[model samples]
Target: MLKVKFNCFFWLFLLIVSCEKETVLKEPVIFTLSSDSGFIGSQLIITGSNFGSDKNKISVSFDQIEGKVDSVAVNKLFIRIPEKLTVGAKLISVSLVDKRSNPAIFNILKSYQVSTVAGSGLFGTKDGNGLQASFSQPEELTMDKKGNLFIADNFVIRKIDINGNVSLYAGSSTYGHGDGATGIAKFNQRISGISMDDADNLYVADYRFIRKVDLNGNVTTLCGAMNASIFSALLGITLVDNSLFVVDIGQIKSVDLSGTIKVFTGDGSFSSVDGPTESAKVIPFKITTDNQKNLIFTEFSLGSKIRRSTTSNVSTLISKESLKLNGGLTIDREGNIYTVNGDTIIKIDNQGQIELVAGSVAGYQDGFGNEAKFFKPTGLFVDGSNNIYVCDTFNNRIRKIAPIN
Candidate 1:
């Protein structure tokens, strides 16, 4: 009888322990989120009960796209918004083992917000903030390390501070070729492109000449001259390391600080053959560099392609019949290329995937993503925060595409 009682007691104890374990492993329940809406790469904090302490066992997803868990606790999950999610309301859920949490509605904002940073939408040289400022054919844009923007505005170089204040950085109202102080120096009517170096010095493609403007706004001719045969037409200019690469007519040329110019790639032919520098032929325009220092440029012909020139050879990165590349080209810190096609801003990822970031029609309107409109948006610059600044040439305004707050 005692043995029978002992067996019953042992079985009852086992049943109780099993029930307790089941109670401990409860389903995750998300009660609140730090933010109900955010952009890609923004952090979101999820808080609720019964999430459990094991991060490996906890999984979070936004509309089935897995989010990166930055940190985790039993009742709280800190995660980053996942990329490639469609911009709209998405169901976010947390899963613990076989049990899933209640779905929470979270709105995903567009990757960028389009707004006018400066320019009065009129062609003039007035310098101020917001709509108080004006630009005359703003061509190319380059931002310094401190977030100050320099623009190649026809006959002068204009500057926009981080606070959106606009002022003339270089050149004079008189259109001519002269190198002196910022106020005294004169850039010809054709100021094609501008680039900045580590020292905040601006290297400008002033027609056939490459001019260097020091931090103190002193302009000096770096290379090329009226009588020099080294260049047919100076187009896009970019600074990679100690060398300045520029697109000259149908070829890519590199100019050293000592004013020495050499053929970096291409044989001055307009063909699209990709090979070693001697055998390659490219009709290059709007040159920039990737994180690997590989030269990237746009070829307006051959179905509008983006090509990369490595030390070994040149190759096509992206080529599509639908691309209408008419504006500037730039690369973000992540090596993603930002360029304009017609009135739209396009982003090409490292994997060659193409996405239209903003704008769908040609006009002058500011909104988000496709709702925005730009008229002949030319120069492009992606700042450290991934905010894009555009020279809306025909609109005569400098537009900014920034992250949603």
Candidate 2:
């Protein structure tokens, strides 16, 4: 992974001041302008300049609708185009408070044929920061309640605002924490899986521990058993009725913000021991909650499946089939269950039916015009707007699936 580190301001300042070569390396900026994968929007970034100077004063216009600059630095700026330009690419003009630039043009590529905040990250590829191939991996991704993007690689988690500029949220080569896990764990201890609560507070399930993180990346450990069951590998989490649901092997456990644990179901084990010969069943991969406050879980099998029951009774409801090799599972506000298997995305109605929503993608290539397709998919989630965000894992892209008109 080639790590490209630059300040978002240096692009605009164009001012190079040399210190001890080490000091100049601290936090500089880098700037660029490009269109999105679907070409419906342009992701404009201004780096190497002091962007966070005035939050309210930061704004961008695509010569179309108004776009608010999400994050600014001495090195980068991220902005999104409007929904009107869903078909073709266009030239985009970006302006800051005192700096304005001409149209910077580029082709937009689709992720699994879906529009999302993370399209094919080829811009950072042909001329990139070093981890070009990794961006194409789409490994682990999360979207905040407001629809911002957070991508996790080997040692880093990036926070991407609506405007599109991505900043490093966690991880490092020598400082901060170790890069042993795919994502950041809570309290900077064990690295495990990631999730956001209803209030958008970040939660990480590291090994057997669960911890809360503040906006500035501060972590506070909450729950974990030192010598616990296989259920300690918390893969997914969902918040409902003022409680938190965790998905491990063989069961869905409920924990409160105050740190209490209750086994909702299973023989009391996780993936490592989910089998009868072992302890429980096949491990639970992801979990979600419906609008009715019911807990639902997705597990990998020949035909992927999800089990639902009353939170208080892992003993109450029946376990239903969801999909094969399910990755990420989430329910929309309309009570629809969404799951991803391989490159296929499916939607299940409340009546227990499966339907192909989008992403029957067939090929893998860094696309420019119309040659883009989906590859390995890892993370999947749904926003409040009914827009589906997919981490096209292998293709190093994040795809968004919208209803076709």
Candidate 3:
């Protein structure tokens, strides 16, 4: 009986050692992961032993959420952290068949949130009912660092607080340019574009004038008088670095803090010709600048264009085609261009691929991407947090597209 028991134990030991060898040889090993904590949709790089060359055989997951594998190599795997995941520690595991490697711990974070905070209508109305209030022909939208949203609604500048409270920040009911105290002052003319400087002061393009409004609602004409020759009409405005890029009647002009303005682009002509600054198409509608100080603006004449100014001040047409990209322009941190192309909001990625961000079928629905609809959506503002606030014009409301969380 003792001999038989010893034989059985020997066989068992051999089996255990063989199983260990198989595990060591066949199981994929994990050495390093890019980050232990990241927001949903963050790109994570995992590296180390034996991820395998055949990506089809491998699988990765965060907690119960399956990660979208961007790419896979023999020893490295690129994964986009799954979206809509709860914020907390999640077990990250990579596996091939039954050879599941030791799990790693990753923490998921909250990302940008997209929602409609105001307005509800098939065509929009100026309800003025606060949180559920609506807008009337909202043109330009800008945001301060403190989360306050400002809209150039018709001739008035309205403010939507962080808590979604709406109130008239500047301008009076009556239209026409009038610079004075807060409520008494009037934006009697049309406001084509509006932007905020580093100090949170607003630069408004009111027909023939560029007005400045302080925190206390003090309106001051920054540049361009009622008959200033510097601009025929100021359409789009953007504050970049320390300068303001304004789209005049036929050219893009750069104005210094002291109000000294010069034609930054446009060959002093408003034709559709693309050439050097002095010969480039001058009639620009909306203007925005990138981190590199490159001016981006849109034109709707001849071959409609989304033009960019090169470092050497040369004009470069960027939009895939000549489309009427009417309305506000903003660029993301990744250099993606977000603009209002009529009723739809389109995004031009760094690779120049145009994709729809919102507003497809048109008319108000206020749902997720593609599912959500807009009526003549125009004016876009991207905050420091990458939240996209859109002026749903015909809907008379501001819609926000919070990035993937």
Considering every candidate listed, which one attains the maximal lDDT? 1
Q: What tens-digit string does per-residue lDDT give for candidate 3 at 66-172?
A: 88878887789988777768868988888876787878888775444446777654333344544467677787888888999888888888888888887788887
What is model 2's C-alpha RMSD?
21.6
- TM per candidate: 0.75, 0.58, 0.70
TM-score, prediction 2? 0.58
**133-215, model 2: which lDDT tens digit per residue?**
33525455677867677665433455667766555565443224222322343223323357776666666665566656656
Residue 157 of model 1 has an lDDT of 92
Q: Name the regions of candidate 3 deviating beyond 4 angstroms.
A: 1-114, 120-131
Best-matching candidate per TM-score: 1
Q: Predict model 3's lDDT versus the native.
A: 0.77
- Write the residue-wise lDDT of candidate 1 on 229-335 in tens digits: 86888889998999999998888988998999989888776789888866788998788888999999998876799999987799999888888987899999999
Q: Identify the superior model by TM-score, candidate 1 or candidate 3.
A: 1
- Total clashes, candidate 3? 9
